[model samples]
Target: MDLLSLDFLILAGVMLAAGAATGVLAGVFGVGGGALMVPVLFEVFGLLGVADQVRMQLAVGTSLAIIIPTSVRSYLGHRARGAVDMTLLRNWAVPIVLGVVLGAGIARFAPPSVFMGVFVFVAGVNAIKLISGTRRWDIASDLPGGLLLRAYGGVIGLLSSLIGIGGGQVANIIMTLHGRAIHQAVATSAGIGVLISIPGTFGYILAGLGQPGLPVDALGYVSLMGVMLFVPTTVLTANLGVRLAHALSRRSLEMAFGVFLAIVSVRFLYAMFAG
Candidate 1:
């Protein structure tokens, strides 16, 4: 756990590469990088000998902390393109925060197996939807208002926090179903990641406070080393992802995202069963 040690240095380098890759995915898929980061962090934590009981929590928290900056960068990039839907973001913010707090509390008591199961399940669902090209499917012409909107936001936040994701997949699905354009849905999802990460990160910290077996230099469950290693690289590469997102056709992006989700889901499922 020594920050200056060779092991930590090597881990940092690995995490830097992971962060760069995650940033591009975040920009392209609006997923806030957690879908990728959590699994990688889980493997790294295991290698570092993090205690089994706290490893998942640390990974989830650290992923959210890293997301804050990356989400902001992606949001800015999308905004410049006039793709973001600010009204939706504003309407959903409060409920999303509330749900994130609840999710952090749940994560504090939930077993790692439960978190892994949830990740696999959610990723599977997302993969199926993307691959099926269901973006135009709709339950309504516009998003639900008032109580329904709050409920939807809460669900998005709850699920995202559980899986350490940015809630983009869910948000994009909902928005597109409600008649939003694919590009707009993606852009707004980046903003949702910012909302989710800010509150979710603090909530995890509070939830993990005084918990046992956390790695060194941890703020509650949030790994300072992970944040240090991840943030800069993600920020630097996110713009490149945004450019790619703009270049690709909507169908191409959807297919690519589907393939990525399938890979991630399989990885988590294998980890869950193998353990």
Candidate 2:
């Protein structure tokens, strides 16, 4: 695809709009915008005639790059309200980063079909959990500590990196189930995005370094154009999402997020089967 072409400019505009929406969702749901951005990026890259072999990798990597800034915006917004759990964020950082490195390595070698399948499955399960409004289940009194905490962080980081997310969904689930307030969980999840995206971004870059069929202005599999066009809008809208999150009731937020996840899941499933 011609980076200078009219079509590319139009697509870049679309990406900007998507990034704004993603930022709001990231702040509101603590999803880090990856769940929303990855699929859209994949489609955009496909439209640009990116090779199938590297297209999903590019999408995932670029989505992570965008998250680097968006998540920071979200964290700041949530922190200002005193909703963030700094202790949890501090404890989870190391393991999550390690997991991101592992996940990025796997993503580099795995086929697009495998990644798509994993995304569809995880998103579907999370959507069902959100829709059901089941908060009674509790296996622990609080967030795990010591080795268990590290393991949990590792799993969240691994799955999040593989799917190009900020690890918010899984982190929220863990925190909520362990008796954390919904607001705190959502706030802390933004920090988790920082932990995951930093390592995941570089990992993808190293993994895809010297690879063929990448789009123009790419750093490894990450698209510079996508990052440039997306980050600003995300930064602008993330605070709005934080405001909305504070305003809404927990049940309302859960239901809305559930619907969003369902839509994402359905889209992935359709792509998987129809493509």
Each candidate's number of clashing pairs is 0, 0
Best by TM-score: 2
Tens digits of per-residue lDDT for model 2, 1-275: 67569887789889999999999998898778987798889989989899989998999999999999889989988888888889878888888998899999898666556766766676566567667877556556787679998898998998889888998877876776677777888899998998988889998899889999997789997999899999999999999999999999988887777787688778767767887
Error of 2 at 132 (Å): 3.5
Candidate 1 least-lDDT 10 residues: 110-119
lDDT of 1 by residue, 221-255 (tens): 89998899899999999999999999999888878
Local lDDT at 266 for model 1: 83
lDDT, model 1, position 137:
45
TM-scores of all candidate predictions against the true structure: 0.90, 0.91
Off by over 4 Å in 2: 1-5, 111-126
